[model samples]
Target: MTEPKTRRTRNGARLPADQTTPRYLGENIEKDLREVSERTGGGTMQSRILVAAIALFAERGYENLNMRTLAGWVGLKAPTLYNYYASKEQLLVEAIELGMTDFFSYILDGIEDVPREDRLFEIVRRHAGYKMRHRLIARANDRLIDPQFARMFLPEDTARHFSGRMADYRHTVEELVRDYVADDALVSPKVATIALLSQCDRMAYWYDPGGSMTPEQALEQVTILIRRMLGIAA
Candidate 1:
């Protein structure tokens, strides 16, 4: 059998040979922290801490992060950090909620005004754009679906709320797929919805802002691929 071909980003990070497979998360912590700091500049101190916490949790794993380390990243003493977030778990929950809130708001904003036929494409475009622009929070959002993390780390109410929000998002996509493919007998909305989201979401693992494609170009290319996948005519 011929070996599958892999490609490297401009930064020389190798991606999976098969585009359908999600790539493993790997990033330079120092670089990510610097970017996070720059992005959160002028935000409230609490907001800065939350952003730092998300970046740290995403890159270092929730179990691997501690209050002291998180505080140090945000220039706070451990006890002072507790004034903002009672515990690391609280911080995690808040971070997840904040990230999801921003994601949903960004993607859904003005979607209602879009022509019905173009709504799915708009959503996909926004999703791809957000993933590229907010790499750290996107990675942190990915952790919400990890079986181990949900089962072991999340509080019951928080887990239930997150799961419900995710399900609602999936259902929204499925509805869009159903409407988009209403005339096609062969496409299953449920399956197509999963495929479409999987394609866009996986970009978080391999996309590099410094890569050959600018964010605008990348979003266009991704929406084009998704349109082709869904058999939408240009």
Candidate 2:
């Protein structure tokens, strides 16, 4: 019999929605996928550690956030923290996967649901809003797994897995572009997708929900930008 395929929270081409217990929360899911080795001092320890990791990673960037520092932040000995993450690379990979999983499962799902012409605008707005809402996680994702910097953090296996997901995710964007172009809705599908991703990816760096605009307000502005780029009358 064929081996049962593991029910992954992430995958290439299409990621499955998280059906697991919502209690297990974090951007880095690989750490949580393994059997728990670190005993929780309290029920909230896991959640706290995850948040701490995100904050620290955002502050220091992946290159500087070593295991020892990470462990110290969580009040665990470096060796003892191995109970939670076998290695820093594995942990980084899992975190990257979590962000992408959310990206595809929810954000891309929204793109797929709407009609082709409106899809790109919806994608840009939602993508910007998501990065704003999950700022720290989004910043880490942008820096850590970028192709030029990927080798410093991800193991070979992790890189392969991540590359697969990224290609699949881009293909989804490409499909939308193609549909819009076929209908004369977009001037240049490839350029449009590239521009959209570039614009949306930067939202993490500057998003401030408490600043001059709320996320909804920002999303509306981004929607207008996308529509203008597509030459759609507002």
Candidate 3:
């Protein structure tokens, strides 16, 4: 092997195009990636802290959630979390936003392009199963969304961000109900939809994954009830 070719930059530094990267440049890229990850909290330990924070917030609610508890869950010193999130409120905002994103994404993704007639069953099933399976998300979402809860206590910007997510969730569900009524699958569109959603959403309040009734069984009963109430077939 004589010598690999190289291209020179304006400063006369050589780069082996598509062949090899300079050691200094490689180090710089790695450094930048780490910096960005730190700022964005996408690093492994940082994300773990967020996960723990969400779980704690869900299990204990905001007032009970503290930096020490969050740090304990992430297996880090309390002061170490500052390296990722600026404060507990910032952590709460990020975790709730992520949780809402997951909740809506899972529900909407399941119902999209699905006919209103079929959507009834899917919604009930998804709602029950999600609440049962993702208890932390269920608890956290419920607490954050209580009309007088987070909105009244959290920072204005953080609270407003959560309010937007809550609004979008309501709108999407409303649209689904409207579609159902337009298709003649449901009567008393708004009233019936609200009633039915309240029924499904409240399951999280009492849902026990370890209980005798599995999520599927509970969903089946709720679906049957809603179908009967709406005059939907099966």
Candidate 1 global TM-score: 0.78
| Model 2 TM-score relative to the real fold | 0.67
Residue pairs whose backbone atoms clash in candidate 2 = 28-95
Please, what is the whole-model Cα lDDT of each candidate in the order they appear? 0.72, 0.60, 0.62
Model 2: residue 28 alpha-carbon error in angstroms: 18
Instruction: Compute the lDDT of residue 58 as modeled in candidate 2.
Output: 46
Measured against the true structure, the TM-scores of the candidates, in listed sequence, are 0.78, 0.67, 0.69
Q: Which ten residues in a row have the lowest lDDT in candidate 2?
A: 15-24
Once model 2 is optimally superposed onto the true structure by TM-score, how far is the C-alpha of residue 45 displaced, in angstroms? 5.7
Candidate 2 off by > 4 Å: 1-58, 61-63, 75-77, 109-118, 182-187
Across 183-209, the per-residue lDDT of candidate 2 in tens digits comes to 455456767777777777778777675
lDDT, residue 166, model 2: 81
Model 1, stretches more than 4 Å misplaced?
Answer: 1-42
- Report the Cα lDDT for candidate 3: 0.62
